[model samples]
Target: MEQLFSKALSVSVRCRDSEERKSTIRVTIDLQLSPSAVHKRNLHVRLTDDKDPYFLFTLSISEEDFQSLKAQQGLLIDFGSFPQKFIELLELCHSEQEAESPRFLLQLCSQGPTPEGPSSLSVVETNAFKHLNHLSLRLSPGSDREVKDYLASCLARLKEEREALELRLKRTEEDLSRQLSCTQQTLCEKSKELEKLRSEWTSQTSSLSSRYSDELQSEREKALELQRRLQEQADQLRQELESAHRSSSQQLRSRVGELEVSCRELTERKYKNESAIRDLRMKLVAAEEEGQRSKQQVLSLRRDNSLLDSQVHEKERALSQLQMRAAVLEQEIKDKELLMSRTKDVLEATQQQKVSLEENAVGKDAQIKKLEATVKSLSEELLKANNIIQKLQTEVKSLVGKIKVKNTVTVSQEKVLQETTEKLQSAEKELHSSRQQLGTKEQQMCALKEQLESTVQKLNESREVLKTNENVISWLNKQLNERQMTRATAPEPAAAAAAATSGAKSPLYPLGRATLPPVGGALSSPADLRPTTQLDVAALDSKYFERVDSIPIYGLTSHLPKEIPRPAKASLPSAYFSA
Candidate 1:
C-alpha cells in the first residue's frame, strides 16, 4: 500500500554533536536549491532490517564537515520529518504489529533530528544499538538505581582513602620531629666545643707555675755566690790568697756549666710551649669555621622549617575546607537518597497505573470486537430471512394458481403441509443456536467484570502506596529543614560547648553550666562566638569608654569615662543595635 500510494527518493543525512561546536539546521524550500518539484527532500525515514542495503540512505559528507546536517531531533533515526511520512514509515517498519509498536515508533520519530537542506540526506551510519545504549545511559540518571549505589560506594572508598592519606601525613610529621631533634643535638655539640677550648687554655695557664718556681731557685743561688765572692775580695788582695782564688775559679766554672744546661732545657721548653699555642690557635680557627658553617646550616634549617610550617598551615587549612565540603556532600547524599526513594515510589505508582490502563484498553478492544461480530452476524441473518420470505411468497402464489385452475387442492395441500413442516424445523434450530450464543456471551461478560474488579483493587493498592509515599516525603522534608537549621548555626553549639569545657577546666565553674539565657536566640555567627578575651579587649576601646559614664551598665559601673573608642574590629557576626 505504501509503495503504491507514495513515492520514495534518495537523500543525504548527517548529524554532528560535540562539546566544541553546536549547530542547528533548518530547511529552506527555495526553488533555486531544491530544483526538483518531486524532491523527497522532506524525508521521513523508516527503519528496516539493518542488514538490508536499502535500509540506509548513504550520505557523503566531507571529512572536515563541521555543520550539523541535522534539524531539531524528533525521531530515533537521528532526524525528524513531516508527520505523514513519519506515520507511513512507522507503518512500513512495524506492519506486523503497528498497534503494539506505537510508542517505539513515536520515540523513533521524536528523537530523530530535524534536517535542513535540499541535498540528499544520507542515512546515519553509526550503530543504532550504540545510540540506543547512549540514550539509555543518558536517561538512567533518574531510572537506574544501581548507578546511585555505585556512586555511593565510590564516595565511601574515597573517604577511606582520604583518611589513609591523613595518617601518612601524621607519620611524615613524626619523622620531621626526629630530624629536628638531631639538628638540636648537633647545635649542642658545637656549643660544647667552645667550652672545651676555654678549659684547655685555663689548664695551659696553670702549667706555667712550675716554670716560674724553677726561675726563682736559680736566681737565689746566683745571689748567694755573689755575696761569698764580695766577702773574699778584701782577703784576696793580701799576700798568700792563691789557694782561695783557685777554689773560687773552680766553683765559678761548675756554676757556669749548670747555668748552660738550664738555658738549653728552657729553650726546648719554650719551643714546645709555642708549638702547643700554635696548635690551640689552629683548633680555634677550625672551630670558628665549623661555627660559621653550623650557623649557615641553622639559618637554612630555620628557613626550611618556616617554609614547611607554612606548607603545613596551608595543608591544614585545605584539609579543614575539604572536611567541610565532605560534610556538605554527605548532606547532599542524604537528600539524593531521599529523592531516589521518592522516585521509586512514583515509578511504582506509574507502573500500576499503566497496568490498569492496559487492562481497560484490552477490555474496550474486546467489547468493540464483540459488537462488530454481532452486527455482522445480525445483518447476514436478516438478509437470509428476507430471501426466505420472498421464496415463500412465490410458492404461495404458485400453489393458489394450481388449486384454482387444476382442482388439485388435496395434492397441493399435501405439498404445502410438507414445506411448512420443514420451515418450522429450520426456525426451531436457529432459535436454539441463538440462545446458546447469548449464554456464551453473557459468561464472557461476567468474566470481564471480574477482571475489571481485580484491576480496580490493584489500582486502590497503588493509591495507598502513593499516600504512604507522600507521608514519608513530608516527614523527610521536615527532617531536612531541621538539619539545615542546625547546620547553619553549627558554631553556636560548638562554641557553647567549648566555653563550658574551658570553665570546667579552669575549676572556676561547674560542668554543664548554662551561661546563655533560658529562652535564647543568641547570635550564631563566628564573631559572636569569638573568644571572650577578644570581647573584653574590644570593650576597653577608647570609643567604648567615651560614653561609658552616660551609658547604662548597671548603676555600680559608673567609674568609666564619658566615652572611649569603639572596638577596633566590628567582627562579622556582631550586629549593632540602636538604643
Candidate 2:
C-alpha cells in the first residue's frame, strides 16, 4: 500500500470468477489520500480505512445486519464501479490537503473477478485510476452540504442565548420599578397621617387659647365695674359729710371747716387714683386680646409653614428623581453618542477603506475617464471632421449660418474691444489733464480758503441785518395792526373827522391847509375837494379857484363851487336862502 500510494498507482479488476459474487457487490470505495508511513505490513488503525485513504463511498450495508468488514478489506475491486467510488470520494473529502494531493487509495472493497490471478491487483488499480476521472465530478452535491447545515445550527443557538438574556434584563427592570412605586405610595399614606395629627393638635391649642383670653377679659371687666361703683359711693359719702360738717361748723366751730375741706381734697385725689387704675386695667385687657389674636395667628402660620415645608420637601424629592432621570437620560445620551461615535468610526473606516480601494483603482479609473474624455473628444472631432467634410462637399447652408453667427460675435467683440481700448486711451489722457488741473485748482482752492473767512464774516453781517429787519417789521406790523383795529372800531368817527375837516378849521392840527375855513373866501383844501383822477397838485393855482365861482349859495353863502350855472331862470325857490 505504501509503494502504491507513493506513485499514485492505479489498478482495475473485473469479476470473472463468480457471477453471483460480483452481482452481490453493493458497496464501492474510491479514495484520494497521501501516505504518512508505509512501512507497516500489518497495521492497527483506530479509524476504519486508516491504513488506506479516506474517500467518499456508498455503502449498501443494513444497519441491523452489518459485519466488521472494514478491518479485513482485501483487493476485490471492479473497474466499472471504480468511477462511482472516485467521485463519491471527492464529494466526501473534508480537508483541502486531502483533495488537492491526489493520493492513491487501497481497494478494500468488494471482490471482483479478474483475468490474472491474485497478482492482478496492479492492473485493477491502473484501470480504476483512469475510470475515476469521469465520476469524480459527482461528489459535489452531498459532501459540502452537511457543513453548512452544522454551522447554521451553531449560529442559531448563539442568537437564542442573546435573546434570552435581553428578555431577562427587561423583566428585572420592570420588577424594580414596581417595587419603587409601592414604596412611594406607602410613604404618601404615612405623611397624610402626620398631617391629620398636626391639624387636630393645632385646632385644640387655638380653642384653648381663645377661651382663656375670653375668661381673662371677663374678669378684668368685672373688677373695673366694681371699682367704679365703689368710687361713686365714696364721693357721695364725702359730699354728704361735708354738708353736715358745714352746718354744724356754722353754729359751733369755724376752725373745723379747714379739717373738712382737707378731707374732701383727699377723697377727690383717691377718686382720681381709682379712675387711673380702671384705665390701666382696660388697657391691659386690650393688650391681652391683641396678644391672644397674635398667638392664634402664629399657630396658624406655623401650621401653614409646616404644610409648605412638607410640600417643599416633596418638591425636592421630585427634583431629585428628575435629576436621577436626567442623569439616566444623560447616560443614555452618552451611550447613544458612544454608539454613534463607534458607528461613525466604523463608517469612517469603511469609507477610508473604500477610499483606499478607490485610490488603488484611481489610476485605472482615471485612465477610464481619460479614455471616456478621449472618446468624447474623438467623437466630437469626428463630428467636426464630418462637418468639415460636409463643408468640403459644399453643404454651405449650415456652415454659412454658423459663420454668420461667428462673424457677428467677432464683430461685436472687436467693437467692444476697440471701444474699451479707445476709452482706456481717453481715460489716460483725461488723467494727465486732470493732474494738470489739480495744480491749478490748488491755487484757486487756497484763494477760496482765504475768502471763506471773509464769507463767514459777511454771512454773519447779513444775519444781523436780517435780525434787525425782522424786529423793525415786527414793530411796524404791530402799529399798523393797532391803527387798523381802531379804524374798524370807529369807522363813523373817521368819516365825521373827514367831514369836519372839509368844512371847519381845527384847533388841534399841525398844518393849515388840511382844514377848510368857515367863511367862503378861501377855496376848499384837497381834503374837502371831491377826487376825480390823480390831482395835479403842483400845477394848480387857479383852475380850482376859477371853478369855485359857480357855487350855489345858501343864505348868501355858497356851499358848492360858486360858478353855479343858471338853469332856465325859473323863479328861485325860497328854500334856497332859508339857512
lDDT agreement with native, every candidate: 0.51, 0.49
Candidate 2 ranges beyond 4 A from true positions: 1-267, 279-283, 286-290, 320-324, 327-331, 337-579
The parts of candidate 1 lying over 4 Å away from their true place are: 1-425, 491-579
Taking the tens digit of each residue's C-alpha lDDT, what string does model 2 give over 444-514? 98987677665455445444544544564454344333433443455566554653453254223212122
lDDT of 1 at 290: 100
The ten-residue window of minimal lDDT in model 1 covers 133-142
